[model samples]
Target: MAIICRNTIEAINHLAFRLDLGPDDVVVTTVVEHHANLLPWRRYAKVRYVECNPEGTFEPDAVAGALRGNPHPKLFAVTGASNVSGWLPPVGGLIQLSHEAGVPVLVDAAHLAPHRPLLAAADYLAWSGHKMYAPFGAAPLVGPRRTFAMGDPFLAAAGRSTWCRSTRCSGTLPQSARRPDRPTSSERWPSAPLPVPSQPSGGRRSAHNEHLASRLRSGLGAIEGSRVLGPGPLVPTLPVASFVVEDVHHALVAARPAAEWGISVRHGRMLLRPPLPASLARD
Candidate 1:
């Protein structure tokens, strides 16, 4: 079952509500996740971090190690691709590992949806329509129908009449308003079904993205003192690259080029870093 939400964050919040996560429950996620995937869990469950390599990559063994002794884990949430480094983690292997432990997996596909296909192994997928060339205000969470039925309603409004009774009062209620039958499968949620589009022939877009990513990485590598983050150029990734130049602040790197040559680029620690304690930062 899928539900339409205002954004991916909203979808996550609804999923959290459905799970009825409590203080004892734990949600296993990676250190490379965006804040949207992490913060929602903090509200209702304990979050366990799976450390990634310095370049923001992890394998299935690392995930298995994290889940070995944990007893209260309810879900395993991860991102399909890194928004900053564009690293595509081993999602299929990770999903298999989590399922072996009797846990469901949720995939945050905000960045990957635009560049590549998502794996069918994921239990839940959350994505934004704007990322895929559509207008804003269209984000959908696709998952099994049983999951949503197990939780509270995402939102309550009129016309969602499950069982209505007629009371003898001064005011007369119309019979059409007294719907006693249970809602059908399609009418169980607030979100409407998303339209399915035609699939691309032969995956031409994915091939093009890989070719461009290789060229971008090669060009960035030639610059002096440039340190590229995440996987190497030949590895599978989105057509995005992030690098830091020695002795240069990221803000200046982003500004100077756009002002001088009209070349727009993003800069700064792109929110992929894990949250640090204030005391640790002071040290």
Candidate 2:
């Protein structure tokens, strides 16, 4: 079953709440997640973080260690892709590893879903609509019904009730709604078809983005004081690139171009902190 949330934050929060985590519970996660995936679990459970390499990538051994080493691990949370370095983790393999260790897996696919297929192997999955160019907030938390069968939703409201009779009510699982719930609208969001990389136009778009990223890397590297971070362009990644120019503040790197030449870029430490050096946190 799926619950439509206002965003990935709420979706993940709902999942974390329904899991009924306690202070003694441990959650195994990686350093590559956005705060949406990381913070929710922190609210209730002790977190065991799996560290990544300089390139924002981690091996299955790391996951294995966390799963086997941590006490009371109830879930394994991971990002399908990194928003900062555009690194794609081996999610399917990670999910299998988690299962073997008897921990369910939750894949935060907000960044990855826009570019590739969703990981079907994940026991629970969450992704946002804004990342997919959807018009408004709509994110889905998908998982087994039993997890949500008994809990009061993270948020309780009139909209969540399928029907109300006297003091008794039948409500949606883990209510992640804002206003009066319209099942049709929320249900349609996840079912909506997205462009697949295998399609002709999608192939072209992918090629174009890769070409752009390659050129971006080459261009930035050629600049006297600048260096591109993360894996080289040959690595399969989203079109995103992060870099730094020596002796320049990251804010200045992003602002100058946008103000002077209409070139918009983003900067600052992405929510995932460690992989990015304090100096090279521009995108």
Candidate 3:
């Protein structure tokens, strides 16, 4: 079963709430997740992070260890790919491992969706459409039917109401069924009349991205003061390379290109804030 959401963050929060998580419950997740995936779980449960190695990668054993340590983890929240390192985890095997341990898995595919086929085998999946060049404000949350069938809606609003008895009200089955008004985005932004650029096939795009990433890594490595983060391009990854130049503030590094060449570069923490694993370091 699936339902539309205002965005991937909302979808994640809804999933977290529906899990019936609490302070006593444990959630096993990795260190390399985006804040959207991590914060929602932290709000309701005690999160056990499976720390990454220096290369920003973790083995199934690490996750297994986390599960064993927790004894009865309610869920395993994991990223399909790292937005910072561009590293793709073995999500299929990870999902299987969690299932074998009697834990449900939620695969945060916000970054992975635009690059590769999704891990459909996972118990729950969530991703944003904007990453794939679709308009913002639309995301999808897909999961088992029974989970959402009987729960009180995450956002108790007008559209979700099934019945009203003076002061008491009931919500619809598949809680998000009436919540998202995604179609309104098109209507609201009709003035922005343009289509997304055409793209190559998935296989072709992936290959091109890999080649481009390799060249980017090589160029950055040659720069006298620059240091690229994560494993080398020889390691399979998406077309994302983060780097830093010695004796330069990241803001200055980001500003020079946009001012001089009209090339916008993102800098700063990229949302991997403090209290996170050292391996998932700031770029």
What TM-score, over all chains together, does every model reach? 0.79, 0.81, 0.84
State the lDDT of candidate 3 residue by residue for 226-254, as single tens digits. 98887756788887878889888899989
Model 3 regions more than 4 Å off: 165-167, 171-198, 269-283
Q: Give the per-residue Cα lDDT of candidate 1 at 282.
A: 20
Error of 3 at 113 (Å): 0.5
- Where is model 1 more than 4 Å wrong at Cα? 156-202, 269-283
Compute the lDDT of residue 75 as modeled in candidate 3: 93
Model 1 lDDT per residue over 158-262, tens place: 344433356432123355443222233433232322323564433777787777888888888898988888886668788898889889888897898799989
The number of the candidate with the highest TM-score is 3
Ranking by lDDT: 3, 2, 1
- What tens digits encode model 2's per-residue C-alpha lDDT throughout 1-283? 7777777888898788888888779999987788888888777788898988887778899899999984859999999988877778888889998999999999998888787778888999999877776645678788887676665536555555555677656544334432232233444464443754465455676677677767777887888998787776678767777887878888999999999999989887534245644322221
Residue 236 in candidate 1 has what lDDT? Answer: 78
User: Sorted on TM-score, highest at the top, how do the candidates line up?
Assistant: 3, 2, 1
Better of 1 and 3 by lDDT: 3
Clash count, predicted structure 3:
0
Model 3 CA lDDT for position 282: 20
